[model samples]
Target: MAEGFLRHLAGDRFDVASAGTDPVGLNPGAVEAMKEVGVDIARQESKKVDRFLGQRFDYVITVCDRAKEACPTFPWAQSLLHWSFDDPAAAEGRAEERRAVFRRVRDEIAQRIRRFMARERKANKDPAQ
Candidate 1:
């Protein structure tokens, strides 16, 4: 859902990319939840965080606790934010329940991303003195 939120704010100020420590493929439930909100992440593939090590990033944000624990140090990152989220893939119970979990996570990610973008825009407009 981070990707979805980024796409929603595309062509704006933020350049966003999401990668995982293990680099597993995109979750189907995640795709469906995003589709419900008019964001198509069906073609977005999982990426390894190592792929971005050579480049510079203003910030590196991890969305899961496990990823935060295992996050690699990005030499050029100005900041690293840990917004730990529940592992929707690990949700148990019926299929619907699992989907519900994914939807909740997706919504939470979207909301957080929106807030982050707003804060970032404000900061860029007025850097600390």
Candidate 2:
């Protein structure tokens, strides 16, 4: 969801990618939640963190606590950021209940992405930042 929002909101400003320590494919609830906001993440694949090992990036961000702990060091990355969010995939209950969890997390992720984009824009405008 973060990737989708960043791509939609940031446009060509940032090259965004997301992976997890333990991927369990894309969640249907997540896809539905993104679709609700017109952000189609249906084609986004869940991938293992190993796929991006050794790659250099301006920022490497982890969106969950487990990921923050399990993520390997990306010394090549200029910055490492951790935004702890609940693992909505782990949400348990009936279909609508699970969808609700996805929606909540999706909204949270969108809000965080907006803040991140704003910070980046501000930093770009200020030389001393």
Candidate 3:
């Protein structure tokens, strides 16, 4: 999800990267959902947050509440934001039901990213206006 969003903003002034504590690899359901919206994530590999520890980030965002709770403090991070979303991979029931969950999660993440991009653009344009 984060990868798709970041790809949308790639080559811009902001630097974006995503990693998970467990790093269980990209969910197939997530890959399909993003593909529905024209974003391909099949090549992306899940990485451990530790891989980014020494780097600097203007904002470190956690897309899951549990991750936010479990993540250790990063002294170099200028800010941390928690944008919790339901874990679509955890969805159960029929196959169709599971796909629905993934679709909903994908849409939610896309909406949040769009809003964030809009605000970022506005902030860049106005600065203090």
Candidate 4:
């Protein structure tokens, strides 16, 4: 969801990709939640962090506590950040209840992405930052 929001909000200004320590494939609830807000993430794959180990990135961010602990270090990245969000996919309940959790997390991720973008923009404007 973070990847979807970042891609949607940043457009071509940033290149974004997301992977997990344990790749469980994309969740249907996530796809539905993103679609509610006009972002289509159905095409995004559930990748393993290993796939990106050889690549360099400007920022390496982890969106969950478990991933933050298990994720390998990207020492070359300019910024390494963690945004601890609940794993909505882990939410247990009926269909609508699970969808509600997805929606809540989706909104939280969107808000965080907007804040991150604002800070990035400000930093770009101020060389000292």
Candidate 5:
């Protein structure tokens, strides 16, 4: 979802990537939630963090509780932010209930992206970052 937001909100500014320590494939519920918001992530595939280990990123954002810990330390990253969003895929009970959780997480992620974008814009405006 962060990738979706980054691409939609500020793709021109930063390249975005999303990965996990243990990938369980893209959740259909998450795809559905993002679809409602007009972000199509169906083509995005699940990938392990190892694929990005050697690469450098300016910022690394982890959305899950375990990922913050499982993610490797990026000495090259200027910043690392962790957000403990409940795993929508882990949501139990009915299908509607699961989708609700996904939507909640997706919305929360969108809000965070907006906040980050605002901060980045402010920093870019300043002579000193």
Candidate 6:
């Protein structure tokens, strides 16, 4: 969700990727949630962090507590950030309720990316930001 939302907003300036220490495949609810916002992540593969072990990222972010622990220090990254969010997949209830969790998490991810991009934009404008 974070990668898709960030790419949707600022792909021109950022190369975003989403991976996990132990991926469990893309959630259908997540795909639908992103689609609600016009971001198609159906083709985005669920990746393992090992695939990106040595790759350089301007910013390395972990979006959940488990991910934060599983994510290694990106020695090549300029910075790292952790954003904790509940796993919508764990939401237990009716189908619609589970999808609601997905939508909520998706919106939260988008909002966080917006703020992060805004800060980046300001920092670019005024080196001290």
| Candidate 4 vs candidate 5, TM-score winner | 4
Worst 10 residues of 1 by lDDT: 120-129
Q: What lDDT does the true structure give each of the candidates?
A: 0.84, 0.89, 0.83, 0.92, 0.85, 0.87
Among these predictions, the greatest TM-score belongs to 4
Query: lDDT rank, highest first?
Result: 4, 2, 6, 5, 1, 3
State in Å the error of residue 23, model 1: 1.5
Query: Among all windows of ten consecutive residues in candidate 5, which has the lowest summed lDDT?
Result: 120-129
Off by over 4 Å in 4: 126-129
Highest lDDT among the candidates is held by which one?
4
List the candidates' TM-scores in order. 0.90, 0.93, 0.91, 0.94, 0.92, 0.93
lDDT of 6 by residue, 1-129 (tens): 887888888866877788989898998889999998899988888999988888888889988997898677789888998888998888999999898899899888888989998899888894533
The positional error of residue 111 in candidate 6, measured at the CA in angstroms, is 0.5
TM-score of 1: 0.90
Q: What tens digits encode model 3's per-residue C-alpha lDDT throughout 37-117?
A: 888989888989988897888888899988988787788998787898999999999989999999998988888877877
Better of 2 and 5 by lDDT: 2
User: Model 6's lDDT to the true fold?
Assistant: 0.87
* Candidate 5 residue runs with Cα over 4 Å from true position: 126-129
- Report the lDDT tens digits of candidate 1 across residue range 48-124: 98888878988888889899889888878889888978999999999999999999998889889888877876877
Off by over 4 Å in 2: 126-129
* Each candidate's clash count: 0, 0, 0, 0, 0, 0
**What's the CA error at residue 41 for candidate 2, in Å?**
0.5
lDDT of 5 by residue, 7-99 (tens): 887767788888889888888888889999999998897898888886878898998887887788887788888878888888998989888
| Candidate 2, run of 10 with poorest lDDT | 120-129
Inter-residue clash pairs, candidate 6: none
Point out the worst 10-residue segment of candidate 6 by lDDT: 120-129
